[model samples]
Target: MRLLHLGNVMMDLVLTVPALPERGGDVVATGSRSAPGGGFNVMAAAARQGLPVTYAGAHGSGPFGDRARAALREEGIDVLLAPRPERDTGFVVCLVDAEGERTFVTSPGAEATLRPTDLAQLRPEREDLVYLSGYGLLYEANRAALTAWVPQLDPAVTLIVDPGPLVRDIPADALQLLMARADWWSCNAREAALHTKIDDPAAAAGALRSRLKRGSALVRTGPDGCLLHHDGTLDVIPGFAVRPVDLNGAGDAHTGVFMAALAHGLAPAAAARRANAAAAMAVTVAGPATAPGADALDAFLRQSRPAPR
Candidate 1:
């Protein structure tokens, strides 16, 4: 199965600090590295699952963009990038504290410059699943482009929407429209709460499931695992235990594996389980796109104890 991931490709500079410093105080970074971010990480996770995946995004003519492309290629993802001559590649500076919590400062950079016309250049064949992230919709240009293209999708093609950190400010009407068009909606607990104004994660997932025309709603609850609501049923999948060195890209890894499992024809519950396992493995590493290989992931799944009833 082929999956197409549409969103930003960023150069992530991750710094592991001993702890979060006080306001205006200095903190020494223990370690630092650069890796892929956003949709790039998702595509990497999917590719690591041995799926045929392609990434669509904007890249600049710079070293960072070159590094991003190389990183995707290393994961076996086909890169379909629109070139931005004037701007540099997008980047995120992530600061991870001792507890694995993170803070991010991002510049949309070249990704923000992508236009609707750029999407028209590529053709998504039938049976290709499309995966989109909320970060793409955070900007007006990409939002308008995605909004225009979503309605034109063929019913046979599945579309998965991951409302990452940026969906809170999206206009309600626009959010509703995108949800209506999506075949699957995935969000973390915080994002679901912010978007639906429902404090409880389960209730927020239910609200999202109810509001969408069709498709399942998945609420990712960090270490608690994920809650899925679809077709008047709810399934809760427990997370696997792992020593997390950095939690920055764990959610993106989960979303990516979820899409890959769906493309591989797994049921929603089974897909969530696979995704949770992948996420558990992701947090054990440090880089933003540090997903496990197929062999490692399979071993991890094999050894994982089942979730308690």
Candidate 2:
């Protein structure tokens, strides 16, 4: 089944500062650069794995939008949305501290213009997976649209949801419905804690699993690794030890590779394992959209995780 990515496209400007600035307290950025940040990061993860990927997110006609479009085309992703000239592409300024934690300030653009009308042309198959980003669920404009569209999807079609940082902001009704329909959910520990009201990572994962009914859930714990609960089975997918330079897109990388593995017919446990490795690789790089193809991931995994004595 092909994977369809649904979410925002962003030009994220990452500034490496000594620490996140306090109000009225300025700190000079030691380094900075713009790179693909949000939904496109997920698409990049799938595309790098040579999966058949489609981008249904909004693409604008602004400079950053142009770069986003070209980058998608460069990766051979089928762009499902045309460049909207009325609005510029969205951007986020991310401040990375010495410990690689990040703080973001955002401005909406064309990506936020995603209306329910935007999805009128989509035709999903049961074998295909429609991946939803949490921002789309939280954004008022897209939320109502998705509330109407999700129920209409053929029961045969699979759903993958990543309830990102805005999980707490998602309306209760919307979150309830999506959880009922979602086959897979990916998020970091904090998001899970907020959404599930469970402080423990493992407990949060279990709570989500219980809520999902027919679906599965994954909770990522940086350095500690990831937890996956699939089809009544649960496992702790180990992570690699790496000096993280940037935490951006790490969850997206996990989601993208996890879905890609499932699309390629790998079992849930195997898919989660691959995703863990992929996410471990993401933080090692500086850019938000950095993802390795199958070959590179395989090499890294084999070398970093040698057979036990």
Q: What is the lDDT of every predicted structure here?
A: 0.84, 0.84
User: In model 2, how large is the Cα lDDT of residue 276?
Assistant: 80
**Deviation (Å) of 57 in candidate 2:** 1.6
Clashes of each: 0, 0
Q: How accurate locally is residue 307 in candidate 2, as Cα lDDT from 0 to 100? A: 20
The residue-by-residue lDDT of candidate 2 on 35-153, one tens digit each, is: 76788889889888878888887778879998888888888889887888888898998888888777889888888777677788788888998999888776677788788898998
TM for every model, in the order presented, reads 0.92, 0.93
Q: Per-residue alpha-carbon lDDT of model 1 for 1-309, expressed as tens digits?
A: 688887888888888899988999999999988777767888888888888998776788788888887887787788776568787888999888887788989987887766778788767787788988888888788888888888888888888988876787776677888888888999999999988899899999999999889888999999879999977998889998888886767888898888888888899999999899888899999666777877998899988864554
RMSD of each: 2.0, 2.1
